[model samples]
Target: DAGVTQSPTHLIKTRGQQVTLRCSPISGHKSVSWYQQVLGQGPQFIFQYYEKEERGRGNFPDRFSARQFPNYSSELNVNALLLGDSALYLCASSLEQPRGNTIYFGEGSWLTVV
Candidate 1:
């Protein structure tokens, strides 16, 4: 099966702009998650969707939002991007097993703001 994948491996934007990142989960996966990793920091959970419904959310502002599709793929959108928003956005997927929480991450989408 194909592993999790993301598009636009890298991007550059200016402050106050908007950016949309895409993610496709592994085959047969039902859960997709989004995370943000700022420089020198661990990846912070942004959103987790299972069965096309939101399952979890992180401590981020409304500027950050995401949604999952029926096919289990997901997209993350950031509005009014700031220099502080420049970081790696990663997507993960799991089997929706609470006991076996093995999430596979993609190479990530790098966003840079000036």
Candidate 2:
């Protein structure tokens, strides 16, 4: 059984461009979450979806959006990319249980905006 998988291991973009990142959860997982990690800092939660519906969101600009499909796969989109947006985008998946449940993370998509 594979853990969470993310596409496009690395990406480079200019300011004002847009990018989309994808993720697939492990089998039997029903929840997918997205996070942004800057250098030397912890990941910041971007969004969380469960059963194809959005359950939570973090303090990100409107340019950041995400959706989960019926199969529990997810995608994260960022528009008007800025230099500050350059970071590692991580996807995590877990069971739709209590808050303390263990969550699995993908290798992450590295994005650099110049």
Candidate 3:
């Protein structure tokens, strides 16, 4: 079975633009989380959805949003992109709460805003 999968391995955008990243979880998984990783910094949790409902959110601006479908796939959207937003967007999946579940991460979508 495949692990988490992400689309558009890389992307480049200008400030004020918008970007959307997609993810598909492994079979039987019911939770998906999104994270942003800046160079020289650890990943920052953006959002977490379980059974199509948002269960957790991190300290991000309103421009960041996400949704999980019935099938457990998810999409992360960022609006009004800024140079500061340039980073690797990662999607992780697990069977339940991330606290104890084995979370799996995708290769990540690299976004650069100039």
Candidate 4:
């Protein structure tokens, strides 16, 4: 499966104009998610949530897992922190997963491994 790809991948604005972000998920996948690699690209695919249950996973090793709570909040857990595991984890929730306009990114939690 492919990671969510953002449209207008790079944005530079100061005119207070409206900016719309677009993210795409792989076919047959209803829910989508993405996150920022510590020192890497914009956002990388983490997993998809289908029918309120966790679905497809990305290239991440067994060390990574995401937990969704009843409050509609989700947490990405990484065991035994490592330099390579550092990243800023973010998520998106929507029944309409295709439209990026409805996609809202939260103030993600950053993990920095020493």
Model 2 misplacement above 4 A? none
User: What TM-score goes with each of the models?
Assistant: 0.95, 0.97, 0.97, 0.59
RMSD each, Å: 1.2, 0.9, 0.7, 11.7
**Please, what are the lDDT tens digits per residue for candidate 1 over residues 1-114?**
789999989999999999999999989889998999998999998998999998888999999999998998999999999889999999999888323789999999999999
The lDDT of each candidate is 0.92, 0.94, 0.95, 0.52
Please provide, for model 4 over 1-113, each residue's C-alpha lDDT reduced to its tens digit, 9 standing for 90 to 100. Answer: 44444353443333322223334433334455656556657778776655446766788766666654443344455555555655566656554543553555544545444
Q: How many steric overlaps does candidate 4 have?
A: 0
lDDT of 1 at 46: 91
Which of candidates 1 and 2 reaches a greater lDDT?
Answer: 2
Which digits, one per residue and each the tens of the lDDT, describe model 2 over residues 17-57? Answer: 99999999989999999999999999999999999999999
Evaluated against the true structure, the overall lDDT of model 2 is: 0.94
In model 1, where do residues sit more than 4 Å from their true spots? 97-99
Better of 1 and 4 by TM-score: 1
Model 4 regions lying over 4 Å from their true place: 1-34, 98-101
Model 3 off-target regions past 4 Å? none
| 10 residues in a row with least lDDT, candidate 3 | 93-102
